[model samples]
Target: MKIKEGFVLHSVGDENVVVAIGKMTKKFRGMIRLNSTGAFIFRQLEKETDEKGIIDALIAEYGIDEQTATTAATTFVSQLKDAGVLDI
Candidate 1:
């Protein structure tokens, strides 16, 4: 899966916020704030990828266990899916 087009991530203060632009503005008007972990996962989703790839990246970057990383990544991806911003 990958992030839908026109959704960009911006660094703001200590957080990363995602904003909609172009045609995406019609469906999603507000930005979504993400924590450090969410920001990392979002970056990975910038291109075509899979659940294992994302989970692996999270584990390598944060030194977290596979189970924990999978859970967090799953939850965040679900949020993007709910917001209609991911090409699942």
Candidate 2:
């Protein structure tokens, strides 16, 4: 899956946020704040990728275990899906 078009990530001081623009604003409004992990996962989702790919990237980047990475990736993806921000 990938992030739908018109959703952009921006860094605000020490924080990160996702905002919708163009036609996306019709479907989603306001901004979603993200922590460091969420920011990383969001970057990965900017491109076309699957959950396992995200899990592997997380493991490599954070040195976390498989289960930990899986949970993190899965939860974040599910949240984005629920928020209607992902192109699944």
Candidate No. with top TM-score:
2
Candidate 2 deviant stretches above 4 angstroms: none
Computed on alpha carbons, the lDDT of every model, listed in order, comes to 0.93, 0.95
Model 1 lDDT per residue over 1-88, tens place: 9999999999988879999999889888888999888899999999999889999999999999999999998998999899888998
Please give, for residues 28-84, the per-residue lDDT of candidate 2 as tens digits: 889999999999999999999999999999999999999999999989999999988
* Residue pairs clashing, model 2: none
Error of 2 at 47 (Å): 0.6
| Weakest 10 consecutive residues of candidate 1 by summed lDDT | 23-32
Instruction: Supply every candidate's count of residue pairs whose N, Cα or C atoms clash at under 3 angstroms.
Output: 0, 0
